[model samples]
Target chain A: MRGAGNRYVFWAVALAAALAAPLALTNNYQLGVAHQALIFALLATGYNLLLGFTGLVSFGHIALFAIGAYASAILVVTFGAPFLVGVGAAAIIAGLVGVVIAMPALRIKGHYLTLLTLALGEVIRLLIRSMESLTHGSQGFSGIPRPEIFGMSFRAGVPLYYLLLFALVLGVAFVWRIEATRYGRAFKAVRDSEIGAEVCGVRTDHVKVLAFGVSAVFAGVAGSLYAHTMRFISPEFFSLGLTITLLAMVLIGGRGTVIGPIVGAILLISLPEWLRFVKDYYLILFGLAIWLCAIALPDGLAGAAARLLQARNSVRGRASLRT
Target chain B: MVELLSVRDVGKTFGGLKALDGVSFGLAKGEVLGLVGPNGSGKSTMINVLSGVYRPDGGDVRLDGRSLVGAKPSAIAAAGLSRTFQNLQIFGGLSVRENVLVGRDCRLRSGMLGGVFGLGGSLREEREAKSLAADLLEKVGLARFVDAPPSMLSYGQRRLLEVARALAADPKVLMLDEPCAGQSQAEADALAVLIRALAKTGIAVIVIEHNMRFVMNLVDRIVALNFGRKIAEGTPEAIRGDEAVIEAYLGRRGHAERR
Candidate 1:
């Protein structure tokens, strides 16, 4: 298939599937899990822009996610702002913070950079905790109102699912568009060789900072959705474990490709719940699965799938030529 | 007749060691200059300084009479100076075409908003860049491997790809550090043809190499360095026959004994 035509078909199918999900799963609990998965998918898609394309490992993404969530909650619940304003604020605030963090974090790379971002994550958490009057400290925030647009409350169930689904589609489309542009090529170039990129006339520093800011915007938007959906916000929700899980999502999905993180997010989000019957062994199995993904499938499930599809197509093309 | 690039008494020091000291050379438009020296004689350092990878501690670099001192690599590149590294700096993960497309990045005007929105201006620019990348790959004789990753390319091919990528910047001055390193004689000859062709287009080409035969045949003029200082500068034949040049290549005692 031609690239553009195939892409349109893929989007159509993905859209139909997403729209039909609520009807197919009827159960509110399943829809809720799906909703959470969509939010995570959005986060992973954004995070992949930095990790997969730009080759920056950041453990501080969870902080951006937290900022978005807290920003939305504080604006909506405390100030009685409209849900849309809160969401927009969340995205802008997170993006600005991302730029600030990246200014220092991008100076160092590899293990040292990773360690720096880790410290940054802890710092954001500490700041939030210490601002007791504003954030209620470790006790967290609750009673976050459901998102409303034109007086239609998306409190739960199908409405929330559809809303999250729409956001996920927009997020995926946004990332897909970026991947096809010159900026995407620059990101990949910087990731591949910073020196080469510099020689090629790319300001790698600017590109890195832009990538961080863009990635934060995605996380922030997802976090806003997550806050409204969950109707609660807390520091614990953005813990180190959440960061690790997001890292796993990107890794397990495949780093550079569009569908990789979404696939990883969906599978990892639902996997533990499906294995809940196994009780204590579920966590152990989940850990082992991630390890196996790292070792056995170095490119992750999406990458593996892409390779398989390419092989099949080539084989078919060869067969037709022989005939 | 116009000088495209001039290096004036440039100096660089790292701790106790002087990497480049008072190195000066001028390159004219449509000229091919060879910079040759033994390992660690500051050949690569000179290229780095010229390309803005290292800031000169003293003196200045000028392109078309504009000072390039203390400019960042990207800024230098934008000012029409582009270089390939001694160690291949190709984007290993990107395809051959994409590698060259990155070279046109400095010329591109589209930003994040344009990219996200896929506006007409950005799309048109992207189409032009892709075609330019394709044209550059063809010029370097790597069109057939346009989709292949750098990892799949041979060392010589990677070197050629690096040249193609650098050329995509459409630089006025192109510095290639050991471009023919580790290549077969035939491969080196192909590179020589490409260098001559690029120079004919009025680019000031600087080829840095230890391969005497390759550089001797490729460049119109030669500059020889030893211990971070120029020992000879003249026609390739003149430099090849100069006693200092011979001594720099061979030891002074060895050359004296031969004499």
Candidate 2:
């Protein structure tokens, strides 16, 4: 935390492992799981901007994901548009909707805001389920083609894994970069104390809105990627359960830190597989993880790690002084 | 008298209680104005109104002839008015330097896209902001804690951090709501010196403090409030002897005894 070198090394090692992951996977099934994990990581990272950085608790974020998925699916399957156009439209549509969601959020605080967003999310989900012609009714959009961009195809699991990996890298890098900028500070300012931020000239409304829009854009891109990779999507998949999972990812991983959501996503996504012995008992584990996180890691895993890092650094400093 | 900031008939009500009645005052550039009163006398309400935290229920506030009555707190801050909270409002998650940088944010021109990409100009803006934050922290005697979180600082240090953060904005008019609340005598003296130095730089200052000794010696003039109404406004010496001012601080019994 003191210098950039250690942080760079951690990223370098992580990146190297991610780039090498596709080759190490035994089968396409594992790669598919990796794909979902990476996509969730990106979505949760963007959502972190609102939850962890800006102190917003939004239950309708999954609705934005639904919008992105549906927007891309409708465009690509029905309109005969290219894959890139579909993803682009998804990002734009979700980002716009995110801004809309932020408007109501501006005036409300705590539980009321959460309730409003929850209702809004349900309405969006219902709209998707009812839009029979566009969303194929409750049967869900299927037969969606794999990603093809610039004459290159990501049809195979490995290539798709690489593509997804690239997206997550870009997404994480963007959050990391923004954390050093003024906007990042503004977001945190709103989270810490809205009145204080306002007094200091930080436009809390704009910050919150920007946070929602940007996070929705992340959900959009993640949704589009999920659609193309899975080749199927249903309104139910982007419902309340997934929203809870996304929240768990950000909260359990580290709410505000760049790598928190990524770690949370990876761990939670794979936790079910690791718990195959218990079959459906993984939900219990998920609940347990969240409960433990709340009591033990109020700042999440990243904050815990940072504390350890600081302690170690202090110890090393004292040792050096003695030497 | 210089008319740098003009407050005209400003009023605020919370429920049935009038927190501030029709109160008016003028602040001149480079003048140190002290607002002293009994605990509930609307001194804080006045600062809150001017800083845009609360929109005045009636009348207007003009900064250099531009009405800021209904402007957002941020807009007023952008227009170069800044203040600290009486109850400390430190950003616990941010380092001390970053907290000050938040104050300088209004003056920054970097866009979200450019900032995310780490564009050259955005980087430069960040560097400049950091340097400014560092400079302000040094002035407020918290240079060593620039990278530490505000929570790590003492109560007095946190207060100083708030001032440093407010000053980082390069405000034309700065208001401090109880800046010396938890400060040691030495720290209070240091802050008084800082206030005088800030006034010398021609930035109009309004300080709300109950420390009469500190206020009397440091401020060029004083305004006393009782029950949200301006009871007296004059030079510090004049305010010191004003019966209304004495009654406001110590009740009618003290005023009668003085008489």
Candidate 3:
């Protein structure tokens, strides 16, 4: 399963879903859920690049995501830029914000950095909330343009769903390529040990900055898609809750692994929707489940599954030896 | 003979204690200088100051006649000086080969965008670096342990791996802080030979060690330190007979059982 065959199977399943999702679910409600899930997938993957691979966490990721969305939203709403340009602008703006935030926090470690980033995010939220003239205050800006291209308006949820799926594919591919390269090795070196990396002549400052920038770019892209899909923008959307959910997806899927984030996003985002029958107690049960999973399977779903599969394979090997 | 590295009255203080005070030394091209002292002698601190780990309170360090006092650690490394820590600072989660690869950070030409696209030039550079790292590993007798992580290697093997990693930087001057700290007699002999061979390549080497026998055999000249002050600087034979050197090593302890 660790070979090309496994990758083929994964891509086949993903492709089938991308093609059939719109056909099977014509209702706007279902399409909306699918679209939102894709956006979450992007956010969760971006978080995975930091939390899983580099062993750095930023509670301010939501703020960077919000900054991207706001930047893009402002461009489209006020300046009338093209949709693609808005997305690019969002990524660059978010990446620059990442550099500013990572500079101070990179010098510190553990909870100090965590708290600093969280406070930074809170500061961004406050600024957004108080800027009555620019950000429209707490009510937020409405009538955001839908994701459109070549004069074909993405007016329906089904079209938006396809757009998000395409984005998810591109994002996943980019991450996969990064994981296989030398830059990825440098990032891993920084995460494993800072002094060790520096002694080896690694400019850890550059590595951390690059990781932050790339992760921010992805988060920004996700945020842009979220704004467009909803056709609305708000300070309420990029909350602490969303940040926690994004982290949960990374942890649950297994941090550091490429496909793990996708698995995490799909399960966590879709699970609550499928459990609507127990809507009243849904959050309580979900939290309990996450707590239990974290304690029992700390490496996340991917690690647990790999362990189980290895055990089964070992047992089979023993059986074959006996024969 | 031009000095490739110079330290001028560098001083470091830890609160009420002065770890290093008014310590000055110079390393000429291809010189194998041994730094020897008893416990709390500041031999390691001198190396730390040169490597930019600790900024000196009172003086300066110059590499190739250029001042490097307040430069960052990476900047110091990039300026053609590399070092190995007394405690094995090899990346534990990385393989031995990968550990060496990290040491080649300054040598790598591939940048962010080049690596992101996996372009031909970057891939070629990566392959070339890997080959060079492999060659260095073989030279240090770590060829078989190429894929083994630091956590899996023995203490002596880890010590050798640190030297191999340092060599990966291709530095003009290499400082080894106690390269023979936790090694056996056989390992120490082998390392002493390796240090001599490295010095033969015309790269200045500074070795910090408490093992008098190893340093005596490996170094051409020895610089002895006591409480951050130089007591004697001469040939290994000359320093061995110096009264201050004996006093530094045998303080309160009888000189009978000393090696």
Candidate 4:
């Protein structure tokens, strides 16, 4: 298929899948799993901004996500603020922290930068855990309010699912818009070659810092939604594992492509849950899957699939010539 | 003629090695100056220091008589100085159009949120940039390759794209490091014509090159260096006949001036 044909097929499949998902998932328990998968989709898209487009693999993106969630949760539960205000606050807090982190981290590159971001994320998590008085620490924060639209609270599983879907759509559209602009060009330039980007008069440092700030805002917004959807907040939920899973999603989806992260998140998040039947060896299978995916397809599943399609077409041409 | 860029006694040392020892030169508007030197002659290092990759250990640099000694690379770029690298640092993964658009970083009027929100002005700016990029690609004779990625192009084509990328900045002064280093004689001759044309448009050009025949034919003035020091500066014909430059070339065959 060409151009819009592939898009039409993709959307048709996506809509069909979305519609069929709720039918198969009859209980709230299954719905919760679906909701978490959607949340991961949002976070994975944000993570890809740094890891894929900008070529900056950050291991501490979860810090920004947690910061956003905590900020919004505290504002709504403790201060009686509006839900939208909490969302805005989450973005601001995450962006501010992102800038702080970028200031020092931007000076470094490659694995060292990754290590620095990981350590920073751990520090933020530890700080949240130690702030027993403010954050409720180990006990966590509960009673976080649901998002209110037109004075109606999204309290149930189905309503929450649609709300999160709307968030995902808006987030995806935002990413789409950015990918077409000069900012996206700058980010890709930095990703491909820092020295080349600089010589071309790109302010690489500014591009990098801006990418981190934007990625943080997305992650923060996702965190706010995650908190409200769960109606609870805790340090345990914002673990390094979530960051690792999101990173895996980005790599599995094809980092620089639009739908890659979403596909990655949905598949990776749901596959482990589905393997619950093999409860004892579920993790072993998960680990094997990740290893297999990495070894067989370094560009991720989306990349591998595209290559396979191309290869098949080429082989068809060769066979036709031989005949 | 008005001086567009002036380097006054700029010097740098990496520990014990004095890569640049009190180098000074000035470029006037629309002038084409050639920097020629031997191996370890500090040609590339001089470009690096002037372009803000390396801070000068002594003295200062001035663009339009404004001090730029301690400015960062980005700040220097924003001040209207743009350059190309010897190694052809074009983004291999991006299309030629996208690479050229990156050159317009300082010229972009869009804000971060403006792009994110798809504001009217930002979108308009983007459309304008696309057309501008097309024009730049045409000027560099890479119009057909606009949609093609840099990796698909030949080395000579990549060099032209690198020049085009610098031109996309719409800079007041263009500092090209060995723009013709790896091209054939025919390509080098074409580049000389392009360089001359660019200089005629009032963009001061400082070209560091090894092709003596090309530089001698195109540049108005020649600045030569040997062992991190300025050895000769005069008209191209005068430097072509200079014994010091001849000796430096003899000292390192194909290495010093090639890169």
Best lDDT among the predictions, by candidate number? 2
- The C-alpha interface RMSD of every prediction is 0.9, 0.6, 1.7, 1.5
TM-score of each: 0.96, 0.98, 0.90, 0.92
Clashes of 4: 0
DockQ, all candidates in order: 0.80, 0.90, 0.50, 0.58
Candidate 4 segments exceeding 4 Å error: A1-5, A8-16, A306-323, B251-259
Residue B71 lDDT in candidate 1? 90
Question: On residues A233-318, what C-alpha lDDT tens digit does candidate 1 reach at each position?
Answer: 78877899999999999999999889999998998899988999999998899799889998888989978987787798889999
Q: What would the per-residue lDDT of candidate 2 be over residues A122-211, giving only the tens digit for each residue?
A: 999999999898899799899999999988999998888889999998898889888989999999999999999998999889999999
Candidate 3 stretches greater than 4 Å from native = A1-28, A305-323, B252-259
Our model 4 lands, by Cα RMSD against the true structure, at: 3.7
Which order, best to worst by TM-score? 2, 1, 4, 3
* Tens digits of lDDT, candidate 1, B1-84: 567898899899989888888989899999999998888889998998888888889998999999999898999999999888
Ordered from best to worst DockQ, the candidate numbers read 2, 1, 4, 3
Note each model's CA RMSD in angstroms. Answer: 1.8, 1.4, 3.3, 3.7
Worst 10 residues of 4 chain B by lDDT: B250-259
User: Which one is best on DockQ?
Assistant: 2
What residue pairs are clashing in model 2? none
Candidate 3's TM-score reads 0.90
lDDT comparing candidate 2 with the true structure:
0.92
- What lDDT tens digits, residue by residue, belong to model 3 across residues A1-323? 35468768977887897788788876778777888888888888887777887778889999988887887888887788878887999999988988888897668988888989999998998898788687787899787899767787776777778788889888888888776565676778888877767767788888888888889999889888887888788898778998888888888888877778888888888888899999879989879978987899888898798779769878999999999
Instruction: Give the CAPRI rating of model 2.
Output: high
Against the reference, the lDDT scores of all candidates come to: 0.89, 0.92, 0.84, 0.85
